[model samples]
Target: MSELKEQLKSQIIEQLNLEDLTPADIKNDSPLFGDEGLGLDSIDALEFIVLLDSFYGIKIEDPAAAREIFHSVDSMADFIESKK
Candidate 1:
């Protein structure tokens, strides 16, 4: 699970082109949206959907579900593992 979390962090930075942030800079439980954590916006959310599909082959069918699933790296990793 930890390994998956690390992979998620890397994926996030890579897929989102977050060149300013390193994998270690992002907390596993940190919010991925808003000004609270990564300061990500809705555009990043759309990219996240692409990231899920491209990397894990997991397509998020419902846009609403992305709000909860992409809330944090931990949650995203859990979602990926469950889909597997």
Candidate 2:
């Protein structure tokens, strides 16, 4: 699971062109969006959907649930595991 989270962090940074951040800079439970976290906006959320589909072969069928699933690396990892 830790490995998955690390991969997620890397993929997210790359997908979003977040050149300023490192995987180490993002905590497993840290929020991935909003001013309280990485300050990511709606566009980043769409990239996340793409990332999941491209890397994990997982599709987010519900846009509404994305807020909960993409909330953090931990949540994303859990969601990936669940889909598997």
Candidate 3:
């Protein structure tokens, strides 16, 4: 689980092109899509959807659903683990 979180953080930083952040900078439970956290926007959300499909082979077709499931690193890990 810890390894998965670390991997997810690395992937998120890379896929989202977050040049300012390292994996250690992102808390597991931190909100990932708002001004308060990483300040990611809709495009980043889409990129995350792509990341899920490409990296985890989890297909998420709905943006609204993706928003809820990919709310944070912990939530994303939970969703991926559930799928697995």
Candidate 4:
């Protein structure tokens, strides 16, 4: 789980073109998309859906659930483990 979370941080940085941030810069418990967090918007949410499918081989059919699953790095990792 820890390794997956670390890899996810890297993926997020690369996928989102967040060149300025290192994996260490993103906290696992931090909100992923909001003004107080990474400040990602709706388009970034779409990117996250792609990220999950491409990297985890998991398809998210529910948009509302995606909101909860993608809420934070910790949540994403937990979701992946649950699916597995």
Per-prediction tally of clashes: 0, 0, 0, 0
RMSD each, Å? 0.9, 1.0, 0.8, 0.9
Q: Which ten residues in a row have the lowest lDDT in candidate 4?
A: 60-69
Give the range of the ten consecutive residues with the poorest summed lDDT in model 1: 57-66
Q: Write the per-residue lDDT of candidate 1 for residues 31-66, one digit (tens) a residue.
A: 989999999888899999999999999888777668
Give candidate 4 misplaced runs (Cα > 4 Å). none
lDDT of 2 by residue, 42-65 (tens): 788889989999998988877666
Estimate candidate 3's RMSD in Å: 0.8
C-alpha-based local distance difference test score of model 3: 0.91
Off by over 4 Å in 3: none
TM-score of each: 0.94, 0.93, 0.95, 0.94
What would the per-residue lDDT of candidate 4 be over residues 1-84, giving only the tens digit for each residue? Answer: 899999999999999999999999999999998896899887898889999999989997876568988899999999999999
Instruction: Record all residue pairs in model 3 with backbone atoms less than 3 Å apart, i.e. clashing.
Output: none
Better candidate number, 2 or 4, judged by TM-score? 4
- Tell me how candidate 2 scores on lDDT: 0.88
lDDT of each: 0.91, 0.88, 0.91, 0.92
Which pairs of residues collide in candidate 4?
none
lDDT of 3 by residue, 43-69 (tens): 898999899999999988888778888
User: For candidate 3, what is the TM-score?
Assistant: 0.95
At residue 16, candidate 4 shows an lDDT of 96
Q: How displaced is residue 58 in candidate 3, in Å?
A: 0.4
Better of 3 and 4 by TM-score: 3
